[model samples]
Target: MTRRRTTLLTGCTALALALGTTACGGSGPVTAGGGDKALGGQTVTVAGVWSGTEQENFQKVLDAFTEKTGAKTSFVSTGDNVSTVVGSKIEGGNAPDVVMVPQVGVLKQFAGKGWLEPLSETARKSVDTHFADVWKTYGTVDGSLYGLYFKAAHKSTVWYSPGALTQAGVEPPKTYDEMLEAGRTVSDSGLAAFSVAGQDGWTLTDWFENVYLSQAGPEKYDALAAHELKWTDPSVVRALTTLGKLFKDEQLIEGGQKGALNTDFPGSVEKVFGPKPEAGMVYEGDFVAGVAKDQFGREIGEDADFFPFPAVGGGEAPVVSGGDAAVVLKDGKNAKAGMALLEYLATPEAAAVWAEAGGFLSPNKNLDPAAYGDDVSRATAKSLVGAGDSVRFDMSDQAPAAFGGTKGTGEWKLLQDFLRDPSDPEETAAQLEAAAAKAYKG
Candidate 1:
């Protein structure tokens, strides 16, 4: 159950993509200089934090690139902390030709520092054809698209076993309060209701984000992400108080609070899907479909299903999202080759390589729905495109690295404390406000 960095992409069909049909969006397959030479046999180095299966899948992508372009491509896994390793490389003037930035805030930091190279015309055309205007907006800073999303994920889903829910006589809830009631009912049936990955505090942060956005709505969400509203604001307290209901009810969470806190994200999913299932449900991105299939042999739509996070506090639930962006560095080494790889990635042919691999979602609007590994993935992709303008980026990812991305500090640590003891939202909010203030200032 290692969390893979997958996508929340929109797709077109294989025939449309193969025939160079304008019906898909692009005029033809993404290429560099039409039939131009392949970078004179240069090597492009790409750095990312992906490892394990995710790395394996991306290697397939790189391998495909080599087969078509003949330019050697190398990938460097950045371990647990990409910022630390990437920062060191940048400081030492050995920056990778391209870096897959998992956080938009970090990508913006690099762009602001002038460490990124502007997208070449070929890559720009791919972006124009494949992605939506919103993606272009996010990639653009000061009127230039320095980054393009290579992978995206929809984070507003609660994965559950339909048969288990049916046997328990519990229905997927449409509102926050109903969700709590159903959890209690499932718990009464001798199954824990929610599998929470509290050990990795980012999951804890995601929990808060889904609720906060649902309760407070996007205007407030944006203001708060930009620090225009303090964490001590009333909305923060309200969201935390709502979240406390499940955390405080030990029977509602798998293995109780302590065990839940000890379990990582994948283990949380495993608890819900293992042979003798301990829990009935887990909430995460659609990529969990691939995980359940890979680890437990669970079929997505049949064995597992999802519903959007319910509306809370009289407001419509917002679709929370996250993704990885590819940015070429202006470090004067193999820059053209790096851009060429990106241009190729922008094509449906390259995306299909990963799409067929399972667990990945692209932001390409023209990518065919059938290109996905299964119906579950296609449904997730449809939901992402159908989400339209209602989607919002992951809140913490929009905040500065010190406040959100740094492990054991700021939002991560504060939210972990909140999850450990849900009784004092006021105290948690105060601490969160203090940390955000200091981190934003620093």
Candidate 2:
């Protein structure tokens, strides 16, 4: 789970920073019209896990917030380990006015510790109006609203190089078998079929989740996530066995197991779309497009494209997702300013700016699909909204951090082992169950 958290936490730390700065007057959709004096002369400090390009983009958003609300604002980078930094700040009695929590589990933990402030009426109205019920539900703890999701990523996508697919004489795979065949075709053509980021074990967890959700359906996913069902259940075995199809074959993955075990996530995407193009495809969340463009200057639809993770055994596509939530600390110095920021983020305008910038998706139903920068982003946005209530939060994210966020332990290490030697799903399942039991008990 530590690896999972890093994969998502690092990838999204930038987007979270990008959206943390924007705000407007309380009444309506935030526009570039003008400033209001509501929270004027007040400064709001936001602490979040963001840096680099995300930090720069957030500055622009904050500048917009300053222009629209007349509230002086600044953002603080909380580094990679947000929970530790935030907890220390709170204990020091200097908590940021607002904090962007990366996972719902963390938000709930904060709420249980009485460190978060429930949303004010103004923020509640904005959330109710702009977001879907599910998003609201995720942000609520004990029937009180404490967090608002400003950005999200749909994880059910497999990014591919269209040119490579064409060269392999295959279309986007619709079924698991077809996907395997497509991999075979690409491999036969002397290219690695998929870039498995085995070095980052979280990607492997994602690989398992998508297949499980689609193959076993949402009820089982929910049960498994809530620990109502054991990790050693037959469904998990089926999911692992299915995923093993790709992991077991040396030629199917870029650089084989060794290459995968060494390549980090960004490198995995680059392997597929980099200059030499070692592989044809990579599976990750919607954020990959932005990373590719920003890092390697690859054109999404032309140089790279994506399809929903193909269904396993003829089931429908499953959407697994993760996002950042804006939460007010109980000791917030400027409550009005914090609520104003949340109100603004709940609008389509705030989402549009980040969307056009690339690699952001909002659950705000008020957002126009056209706000996304390109067809690839638009498709992901559509898939998210289109999935409706069927969408499931990323399984590892929903689990307790002990099992989900611990490094070189629990799911993270076990999955890496499974990838290195996928000969035994049963043994891996037993290991997973034992780790989960101990973590959940703790």
Candidate 3:
């Protein structure tokens, strides 16, 4: 929900800009031989939420594209507020050739406004061959293929320091209650039990989502996402109460509520994996492993490891996920080049470029497992692609931006407030219902 937008030059392009190279191309799996230059003299622009290392990794994929097609590509970061920045660009007649949409709600909104171009036949064919039908289903809006999900994050894993858990003499928990007990034991051993990123309201939504999915089952989860069931329903209250059990105990949190409310996403991960760790556990997407390894030099499956979020009340544990979709903009100047780039992204070759770089997962079934840099990433990618209908997308992403994606209002802000004062589930549920009703109607 950050509103800061920054322009980032692709790694190859940055070097090219400095050294005056002819093209931002590299020899990799996606390279086309025999000096193929079908896309020569073309330039494609992309905008997305990825920044820092993520942006750098994605640029490798673009570099591969340039190698194969002889077309140049540039990337810009829209920060977390993809909808606002991209929307403003469209109105100003300066839309990028392609945009990486982070939320399904935003994709649908853009398509409804006629701002997105349907996928080209070549792109659709690649998707059909490489991706699961469900991935395509998410990309389609009103029977038209408009977005292709290229990056996915498995959100149900809880990462922890293996050494810290061993010191506390507790195994990975199998149930929500068991996890809390382990937290208490770990806390008693002179370390904070969990590093909760309460400042980023979206993280709190994920906490509520995993609990709601496990407790209420898939049917209720779908209904709640669609707003067919009001937020004030008993199921919502039950889920809130379940999450409150973790939040209500300030001792279990790394820096208590106030400290957590000030920590951003990366800071929360640092609390558990930094050189002088303050907490034993951190919960989020599989990307947490990337943060630990890249920033803290902790190896996955050794210093850093994870387990599925524990089941609630003996039900099957849920696999909640989030992904970024690549869509061509209808009003962009480089439509042909944009479609070509989208088509290439659908191929296994493009996916491998990032998978091999670390901290990435692809839903493309055709991509080789060996492309992943580590065993943990490979296994997690396999689980996600094989999850079938059992996997549920992020709940907040399904709602309108006003309710789900906004920084300080609606679900994000409300959940932050709940974390601060979780004594009354019913009151929280009622407030959520009021906000959701207004959001869904608008």
What are the lDDT scores of the predictions, listed in order?
A: 0.80, 0.79, 0.85
Give a tens-digit lDDT track for model 1, residues 1-442.
Answer: 1111121012343222222233345355443222223443778899998888899999998877776556688899998577778878988878798898888788888888778877766567678877777777677788888888888898988999887798889888999788888888888887888999988889988899999999998899988988999999999999999889878888888887788889898898898887778888998888778788889999888989988888988999768888888888776367766776777677777777788897898878777788897887887888786776677889899899889987789898888788788889999999999999998897
Query: lDDT (0-100) at residue 306 of candidate 2?
Result: 92
Q: Model 2, residue 351: displacement in angstroms?
A: 1.2
Q: What is the TM-score of each candidate against the true structure?
A: 0.89, 0.91, 0.89
Cα distance off (Å), candidate 2, residue 269: 1.2
Give the best candidate by lDDT. Answer: 3
Q: How close is candidate 2 to the true structure, as a TM-score?
A: 0.91
- lDDT, candidate 1, equals 0.80
Candidate with better lDDT, 2 vs 3: 3
Per-candidate Cα RMSD to the true structure, in Å, reads 6.2, 6.7, 6.9
Report the lDDT tens digits of candidate 2 across residue range 221-258: 98998899999999999889988878888878888777
- Total clashing pairs for each candidate: 12, 4, 0
- Report the error of model 2 at residue 82, Å: 1.2
TM-score of 1: 0.89
User: Which regions of candidate 1 are displaced past 4 Å?
Assistant: 1-37
Sorted by lDDT (best first), the order is 3, 1, 2
Best by TM-score: 2
